[model samples]
Target chain A: MSVSRFIAAAILATALILPHADAGEVAFSERRSGSTFMAPETQAMQSNDTANPGMLGVLDGATLWGKTIGAAEKSCASCHNDASTSMSGVAARYPAFDDTLKRPVDLEQRVNLCRVDHQRAPPLAYESRELLALTALIGRQSRGLPIAGGTDPRLTPFVDKGRATFMRRQGQLNLACTNCHDDNWYKRLAGSAITQAHPTGYPLYRLEWQGLGSLQRRLRNCMVGMRAQPYDADAPEMVELELYLMSRARGMPIETPAVRP
Target chain B: MLAVAAMLGLSRAALADALRPYAIVDDAIPLSLTGADGDPARGRAVVLLRQNTCLLCHSGPFPEQRFQGDLAPNLQGTGSRWSGGQLRLRMVDASRLNPATIMPSYYRIDGLQRVAEPLRGRPILSAEQIEDVVAYLATLRDQPGKHE
Candidate 1:
C-alpha cells in the first residue's frame, strides 16, 4: 500500500470513531475554545481572579446571595445555605430537566424561577446586573468541573431541538452556528480567531461590552450579527439551544465570571 | 479586526447600486458570464462588505483592506487560475461542486432556512452585483510584485 493510502486509512478510522467518543466525552476537545485562541493580554485577564472584570459580577452575586428580597424576604442563602456546599457542581449540571417546567431550563432560567416561586420576588430581567451577578456566583462554584447534564432520556427531545437550531441557517446573512464555530472555529475572522462555540465561560466580561452578560446575551448578539431577529431572553428556543450547547460542552470545565474580547 | 470591520462597513454602501436579473447554475469552475460585462470596481465593493459577509469567510488582496479571513482560500490570484464562468458558478452556489462546502451561496435563495422576513425569497446579492464582483475578481491575476 502507498504511504498516502495508509495515512488516508488511519484518518478514515479516526473519523468513524469520533461520534461514539463524543457521545460521553467533551465535544471537540481537539478544537480549543475561543479563549485559547485569544491574544495573550486577553487571556491574562481570564486567569487572574482579581484582574478578571467578571469577578465584579461574582462579588456582587455574593452580596445578593445573602441579602433578603421579594415579598417573601428570603435570600438564596435562606434555603440553599452556603452556596459553596449546596451549589457546588450544580452549575456544571445545568440546562437540566425541570419536572415542574416539563422542559429543559438553563441555569439562568432556573434562577429566575426560584426568585419568583420560592423567594416570592420578581424575576430579574434578562442581562440585568443582578441576574448576571447571581448567575456568575453560582457558576463560580463549579469552576474547573466539566460542564455536564443532558444524559437523561427526558432531555433528548430538547437536545434535538437545540441541535436543529444550531445547524439551521438563519437571518439575512444566511449563516448558521456551524458556519463559524464548527466549520471554521480555527480560522481567523479579520484578525480575531474563531473559537468553537463552547458555553464554558459565560456570564463572562467581554472587553467590547466592558461588562458582564449571560450566555443568552451572547447568543442574541450572534443572532443580530446574522441579521436575524433574536428570540426573546426567556424564549423556549433559547432554552433549547442552551440545552444543545451544554450537551456539546459536556466535559469542558466551567469558567464562569470569565473575561473575553 | 476592528479596523478591518470599520473599512468594510464604510465601503459596503456601494454594493446595492443597479442590478439586472441573472440566473447562475452549475457547470464549470469559472462559468461563462457574458450577459453583462463584469465590473471589478463593483465586485470589490461586494467582497469587502461587512453586511454581505464575504470578508467573514474569505480573504483577498485589496490594498485598502487591512484584515482578511482565513477560513477559505485567499482570493488574491484566483483570476489566473479559474475562468469568469467558474467564479460565477461559485458565486451562485458552491454546494453543487462540494455538497458539503461551508461557503454560502451568494445568489441561491431556495431551500434556505430561517431567512429574515423581508429577505425571504431574495438572493444574497443581485445578478448585476454578482457580475460586478466577478469582474473585479478576474482582474486579480497573479502579480509577482503586487503583494508585500
Candidate 2:
C-alpha cells in the first residue's frame, strides 16, 4: 500500500479503538500534577530571569572576531570595529535577502560570506557548537534591539511561505504551530503550557537540553514531534521559517543566549 | 562479550514471565498498588524494553540502561509516593491530566491524525501493557543502605 494509505488506515484504526477504551484508568506513580505546558509570558519571564552558564559560544565568537585569518590579512574587526559599537542592532535586521546573492541571509550566513570573501576562512559547520557560539555572540550585540526583518523586497515570498508553514498542521497529533502558539498559548498540552514562537532571544539554554542551541535546532525538534521530516539546517524552508518567526516577533527585544524550560 | 552476555541474561530473567504473549492479548491485567506487594524483578524488565520507555526521560538504579534525558520524573522510589490509579493516568494518557505532557498516550483516543481505518487509532500498547508497567513501578522501593 502507498504511504498515504497506510497513514490513513493507521489513523482510522486508532480512532475506532479509543472511545471504547477506558478513560483515566491507567496511571504512573510519578505523574506530575498541574499545568503540563508553559505559558508564553511565563516562558519569557523564565528565560529572561535565568542566566546561562554554558554560553561558551559567545566567548568563542569573541575570540574569533578579532583574530586575523587567511591570506587577506584581516579579521571581522577589519571591517566592523568593536561589535559593541558597529554591529549593535545588526542582528534584528537579519534573515534578510542579500541583493547580491538573491537569497535570504541570516547573521550566520552573512558571517560565512565574510569569511569566504574577506577573511578567506572556511565557513563554520551548520549547527556545530562553534558556529552556534559565533552566531550567539554576534546576536548578543543586538540585544534589546527590535527585530527588523522583511525590509528587503526579495524576502517577501519567504515570509509568506514561513507563515503558511507555521499554520499548517502535521504529525500524529494533527497540530499546527499556531494551534498551540497562537490559539492555545495560554492552554496546557500535556504537562507544559504553550509559549509564543518568539525567535528574538535564541541560541539560548534550555532546561530540557541542558545546553545551548540555535532557534533552528529548536524548530527541528518541533518538526520531529510533529512527525514531519524537518528541513536541513540551512535549507530554504528553514530560512523562510526563520523569516516568518522574526517577522512575528518583529518588535520584541533580541535576547540571545536566553534561558528556557 | 561475557559481561554483555551476563547483562542480557539478567535482563531476560527479569523480563521473561511478566510479558508473555497472553499478556499482550488480555486488556485487563491487574496493576500493583504502591503499598501492595510487588516483584521488582518483573518491573525491571518492563522498564528496560520499549514496552514502557520510562527510561527515556528518567534515570533509574539500573546501571546498564543509561540515557541522557530529564523530561520525566525519576523512578527510583515512585511506588512509595503515588497511588496506582495516578500512575495509570500518567502512562495511558498524560494529556487528560496535564495538557503540556510530551509523553505520548500509551493508550488514548484517536484525533491527532487524519485517518479512515479503525485499528491504527492511537498506540501500540493495550490496557494490559499499561497495567504490567504499573506493576513494575510498584517495586521501586528504597533499599535500606543504598542511596543514589
Candidate 3:
C-alpha cells in the first residue's frame, strides 16, 4: 500500500479507538464500574453475600418488607408482594421522573413517599437504618441489570441541572466532580484510588463509614472534603445529581449493597 | 475613659485572632504574614505532611515518598516558575489565579460554606505554616520530574 494510504488507515483506526475522548464523556467501551478499582479483599467481600456486611441491611429489609406498620395496617408486602418478582429491574430505572412532584425522586425518597401517601405513615429520615435496608433490599432485586436512568424526555432539564452541578466549582478547593471522576479517574490521591463516580452501588457498604449508606451520604462526604457546604438531606439537587450519575452509567450493571474502600 | 480603653483592647484582641492582612499586586502577595522570612526546613516538613494535604494532589521532588499524587502539576521547579510572592498567593488561594484549581486555599477562611464542624472558622494552615511552605517551594528550582 502507498505511504499516504497507510497514514489514512492509521487515522481511521485512531478515530475508531477513541470515539468519545473528545465528546466530553467516557467512551462506551472504556467505561468501568467502581468495583473494578477495589482491592482483591474488598472485591471478595462484596461478592460473597454471607461475608458482606451490606447483606445485613438486605436481611433487615426483608423483615421490614413484611412487617405491618402505620394506620393503614399494611406492609410493603401488601402492595408489592414477593419483591424478587415484583421489584426486579425496578431499581435499574430509578431516580426516575415523578409526575406529582414534577421532578425526580431516588429510590429512598420513593420508599418514603409510599409510606406517607399510601400507608399514612410518617416519612423515613434520610440515612436511617430502615431506609437503607429497604433501599438495599429493593436495589438487590436489580442486581446485575443494566442501569436505565435519565431516558425520559421530562428528565432532560433535571439531568442538565445535575450535569451542571457535576461541572460547577465550589468549596475552598474550588474543584468540580469532573476534576476527579471525569478528568483523572484511575489515578491515585494519596493512599486512595479515584474511581469514576458511578451510582451503580447505592446503599453500598463503605469501609471508612463501617456501615451501609446511600449515594447522597457519599456525595456529602466529598463536599465536606472539598470544604464546601452540602445540600439538605432531601434537596432536589441531590436527586438531580443522582439522576445524572445514573444516566452516565446507563448500561453498566447494578451492584447494590456493594462493598468499597 | 476607662470604658473606652477596655472596648478598644477587646477589639484589638479580636483582630489578632483573624487573618493577617496582605495586599495582592497583579497576582502576588508581596508581604510576609509573620513579617519575617520562613524556614525552608520547616516548610519542607509542611509539604510532606499528609494532614496539610499537599502531597495528596501534588507530586514533588521528595524521592523518598512512595505515594505522591498526580492530580496537579509537579512541585519541582516551582521556585523558578513563580516568585515567592506569587507562591504566597497560590498557597493562600490558588483560585484567585486559575478560578478552578483543586488546590485548597490554605490561608483563607471566608466565603467557604459547610466546612466540617471541627474545622470551621479557621484556615487549613496557620500563617507561619503557609510561609514555611512558600519558603520550601521557593527552594524547588530543579527540573520537572520524568513523570511530567
Candidate 4:
C-alpha cells in the first residue's frame, strides 16, 4: 500500500474507533505568542498586578463572591468556599462540556449556570461588568497555570465546530481568524505587531479600551474592524470559537485580566 | 518569558492632523491610468482617519500617532518597494496576488460576506481614496529610521 493511502486509512480507522479529543494536544503556532506582539509598556502593565486595572474588577469580584444574593440568598462563597481552593485551575479548564447542556460552556456561561440553577438568580448579561469581574477573579486563581479543558470526548464535536469557525472566512474583508494571528505573526500593520491569537489573557484589561473586556467583546471588535456584523451576545459561535482558542492555547499559561495596548 | 520593558512613552497619541481633508475624484476613470494627480495630503486622510481605521491596522510615518498597529507591513518604506502602478493594483484588489492575504481590497466589493447591512455592496475605500492613499504611500521613498 502507498504511504499516503495507508495514512489516510489509519486516520479513517482512528476517526471511527476513537474520539477526536484523543488526537493529542492542539497544534499551536510557536512563532510568537500574543504577549510578544504587544508593545513593551503594555507587557509591563500586564506584569504589574498592582498597576493593572483588571485587578479592580478582581476586587469587585471578591466583594461579589462574599455578598449573599439571589432568591436562595447564597453567594459564590456559599458553595465554593475559598476561591483560592475551589476556583483554582477552574478558569484554565473552561469551555468545558456540560453533560446537562450537552455542549461546551466557557467560564462566563458556567458562572451564569451557577447563578440560575445553583443559586436561583438571573443570568448576568453578556459582557456585563459584573460578569467580567467574576470571571477575572476566578481566572486570577489560575494565574501561571497552562490552559486546559477540551480533553473529553463530549467536547470533540464542539471543538470541531470551533475549529471550522476559526478557519472559515468571514466579513466583508473575507478574512479568517488565522489571516493575521496565524499567518502574519511578527508582521507589523500601521504600527502595532500581530501575534498568534492565543486566548490566555481573557477578562483582561486593554490600554486601548481603558477598561476590562471579555473575549467575546474582543471578537466583536475584530468583526467591526472587518466591517462585519457582529453575532449577538452569548452566540454559540462565540463559545465554539472560545473552545477552539482554549484548546489551541493548551500549554500556555493563563493571564486573566491581562493588560494590552 | 522574554519580558520587554517598553519604557518609551505609551501615551495614546492621535495624529489628528496627520491626514489633510481632500475631495474624491471620479470612479469611472480607468484604474490603470492615473487621472488628476492624487493629492498626497488627502490620501493621508483616507489612511489615518478614524472612520476609515487604516491606522488601526498599519503603522507609518505619523509622529503624532503614539500608538500605531503592527499587524501588517509598516508603511515606512512602501513607496520605494512598489510603484504607483503596483500600488494601484494592490489597492484595487490585494486578493488577486494572495487569496489568503488578510488585507482588504480598497475598491472591489463583489462577493463579500458578513458585511454590515448598511455597507452592503459598497467598497470600503473609494477609487479616489485609493489613489490618494497610493500617492501618499509612494512618497515614503526613504528607508525607515534615516533622514532623507
Q: State which candidate has the highest lDDT.
A: 3
Compute the lDDT of residue A229 as modeled in candidate 4. 79
Q: What CAPRI-style quality would you assign to candidate 1?
A: acceptable
Candidate 1 C-alpha lDDT tens digits along A74-103 = 999999999889988898888889999799
Question: How well is each residue in A103-160 modelled by candidate 4, as lDDT tens digits?
Answer: 8988999999999998899999987889999999999999999888577778888888
Per-candidate DockQ vs. reference? 0.34, 0.07, 0.24, 0.24
Docking model 4 quality class: acceptable
lDDT of 2 by residue, B14-117 (tens): 44322322111112223432334434455466667743445544666666654523434567777766456656666665555434344666665454543212
Candidate 3 chain A: 10-residue stretch with minimal lDDT: A17-26
Off by over 4 Å in 4: A1-33, A36-44, B1-41, B48-50, B53-86, B131-148
lDDT of 1 at A40: 93
Cα lDDT for residue A82, candidate 3? 99
Candidate 1 stretches greater than 4 Å from native: A1-31, B1-35, B144-148
DockQ score for model 3: 0.24
Q: Poorest 10 consecutive residues of model 4 chain B by lDDT?
A: B8-17
Residue by residue across A142-204, what tens digits does model 2's lDDT show? 877887877677788889998887877655444567755664454333334445667866777
Each model's C-alpha lDDT? Answer: 0.77, 0.63, 0.84, 0.75
> Comparing candidate 1 with candidate 4, which one achieves the higher TM-score?
1
Question: What's the distance in Å from true for residue A260, model 3?
Answer: 0.7
Per-residue CA lDDT of model 3 for A1-261, tens digit only, reads: 333453465457547753432245666777898899998999999999999999999999999999998899899999999999999988999998889999899999899999998888998999999999999999999999999999998999999999998887666565678878876776778768888899898899999999999999999988877767788988888998999999989989999989999
Candidate 4 chain A lDDT trough over 10 residues, lowest sum:
A18-27
- Better model by lDDT: candidate 1 vs candidate 3: 3
Candidate 2: docking tier: incorrect
Rank ordering of all candidates by DockQ, starting from the highest: 1, 4, 3, 2
